[model samples]
Target: MKKVNQFASSKHILALAAIAAGIALPPQAVMASQITHVVQQAGAVKGTVVDSKGEPIIGATIKVKGDAKNGTITDLDGNFTLNVKPGTEIEISYIGYKNQVVKAGSSPIKVMMQDDSQSLNEVVVVGFGTQKKVNLTGSVGLATSKDIESRPVGSAVQALQGVVPGLNIDTGNYGGDLNASKSISIRGTGTLDSNQSKGDPLILIDGMEGDLNAINPQDIESISVLKDAAASSIYGSRAPFGVILVTTKSGKAGRVQVNYNTNLRWNTPLNMPDMMNSHQYATFFDQAEFNGSGNHLYGDEERKKIWDYMTGASDVFVEEGSGGKWNYDHTYANIDWLNQYFKHNSFSQEHNASISGGSDKVTFYASGNYLSQGGFLRYGTDNSERFNFTGKINAKLSKYVTVGYNARWTRKNYSRPTTVTGDNFYSHVLRRARPVRAMYDPNGYLMSDINYIDAL
Candidate 1:
């Protein structure tokens, strides 16, 4: 009993010492102190964000200075509420604006954000949406109107020939055909030859599967080429090779604006094959024939005649046939088939006009394009003409709903003489037409050959 009393007395002495040192408190008093601290931490901070112009900036972000998880965006009225401790710092930020940090001491705070001096980031169109270029991933090539507008090309695909990397544009045998379509591919033919590969990229204009040649180059606002499989997953099999997304220009909220652009261009063959003259042709032919059959196709007399004709020493170009008809002297001609059939220069022109306007509720954009191109043929009528028209309208019905309508029209016309093959006139001209043949007889009459007739 004495030992238990001695222990109780020691506990009392310790409590007295703690009270004298001001370190001991009652249980109820300690609970009250903790409750008061919890109440102070529960205080809410309300704030409104605005621009330097005093305009409410909706969607602005407000968060505790160092707490990314505790953040909220401003409402439509630029108001935000966040619960934070007294004297805690809060941050406000928005795109294209400078960030602001302030202390949370009072019930309401006003933050006026300043405009950031740096330029805004470029927005790139992705599979089914848009994203900033800095935030985009995967392989993509972007081209704007400035890259293609000034180019003198009939097809938009032609304008992008060397503009984008890994994008292959080929005119091939149809390079001289004014209205001919060009083939487009990406990343080459892969493991297969070009003739056997079906690797054409999918081209989309304003979300519609349209021909790239049909749309006017001037009407295009931007082109996004998605090259990787991950970037084009939304298109599925349609984009097995790649995807080309084209976005057209839209009206902005401003006064009515009109623009007109036109260009005239001349085209000339850069390098043509240096074909053999009559003398060289005879020498080579005789050598080839002798080498193959051990006999010359042309005798010495024929060689002499070819040399004389090439030297312009003989004017005998035609002779009378037995049936009272004139025949071109086959041995008295040395014609340059390429120079005789193709022009040195061709003329082409394009004109474009556009109008755009908008208000807060309604906006519209309309454009027209006209193109006329002439072929390289020196004879016969070879011409192509194209017209394009596009119009779009957008209306805001309410804060949440928007409606839009788009329309496009195009027309093309091309005229040329019949050829031995289907639209392969240039190749036939280069292959079938011989250098010894003349386009016209001595009497200025059309040649009797079917090739000459068809070419005319």
Candidate 2:
């Protein structure tokens, strides 16, 4: 009984102490540690550095005060975030823009950087890297993505044709394999590790080694080529042929964008020569036999009969001595050979889809393409099939740490050996022979091989 009474009295005293402490404690002190820490946290610094008209000044300069190591260049969007020590000072400057300095607090800071000092067109990426046009000391050529997006090629270098001067591009014979793609050459110079001077250009993506074709053209923001030896010297041994720098597309801060691009095309044959008709064909073949270097396959009587038929007077002429209803007339099958083998029209189709968006803490981008194309060859060859995808995501973890990842994958199939297939196709379609005519006579196929003709 004594022990129970003692416990009840102690419990009542503890309850009264708790009530007093709660009433005396500060409202914030009563809250959880996590909520209080969050309230006192430092925010981020963000802004779109732009021209007076609101155009983003991509590749501009931004830095933390007194810290060369703590600096970053503005992206195409002219947006940047500097997570300085909770209260570090930042200096924002560009070649033509007035410099600005500001201090950070627990909340994110937004600044709309305006410029009047540098002309809008006076800045671009050069060999040494992002620089102002007025500050450029090297030769550089900037190419737009819209100019060369029409062609569907397997490599990025091929897309740059004619856009950049001095860069030579060609798809040499598939060396030993027919499936090999073309080779890329810059400036048409260099003969190292090769007896040939067809060295390819040095391709750089985001200042790193990469293939251009692997990137989706829609995802490309721009391309810069360093052609002059002086401008390309930074590439050292790899720059003998010159260098090509490609910048890929990036996410923009705003509502998500959904884009769709569609295209369809038809190829029509042209410039084909007129072929002889049934009668003309018979006459030509008769002459071929009479004046041909090889022994004649038919007698004079047979020749006369065939010649008469070709002159639009195809009456069987059995020499004056022979008598019978013997009249030779050319067959219809022999005249329309060419049209039977080649098609008059073919079609091609391309489809593309893309989605991009971002939030305050993260940004994402993704795209895909599907293509089906047919060729202009006689045989149903040259068809192509392809599929490609690319995606990327950027997440900001803190004021100083960020994580990002990007990936691309592609699969393609194409037909190209049809052109080199040669004479068999030509003879079957262009030869003045009737369908009844045998493709091969006793001794190996009778048609003369045309391979040696183009040789000389």
User: For this target, which candidate reaches the highest lDDT against the unseen true structure?
Assistant: 1
Candidate 2 per-residue lDDT, tens place, 362-401, comes to 9898999887767555444667776779888888999999
- Using all chains and alpha carbons, the TM-scores for the candidates as numbered come to 0.70, 0.53
Candidate 2 regions with alpha-carbon error over 4 angstroms: 1-123, 149-159, 171-183, 188-197, 269-338, 377-382, 397-402, 415-456
lDDT of all the models against the reference?
0.79, 0.60
Local error of candidate 1 at 283, Å? 2.0
Task: Kindly list the per-residue Cα lDDT of model 1 for residues 1-456, writing each as its tens digit.
Answer: 566556545545654566689864454323322222233234777778899999977667788988999877775446667788779999999988999999997768999999885433677788869977767777888888999986888889988889989999877665656766888888886437766766789898988898998999998999999888864578887888999999999888899999999999998887778878877887897899999999987788777777777788876544566567665444446878777777899999999999999999999999999999997877778789999999999999999999999999999999876662355655666676656666677778778653654566
Ten-residue segment with the worst summed lDDT in candidate 2?
Answer: 28-37
Count of backbone clashes, every candidate in sequence: 0, 11
Clashing pairs in 1: none
| lDDT over C-alpha atoms for residue 414 of model 1 | 90
TM-score of 1: 0.70
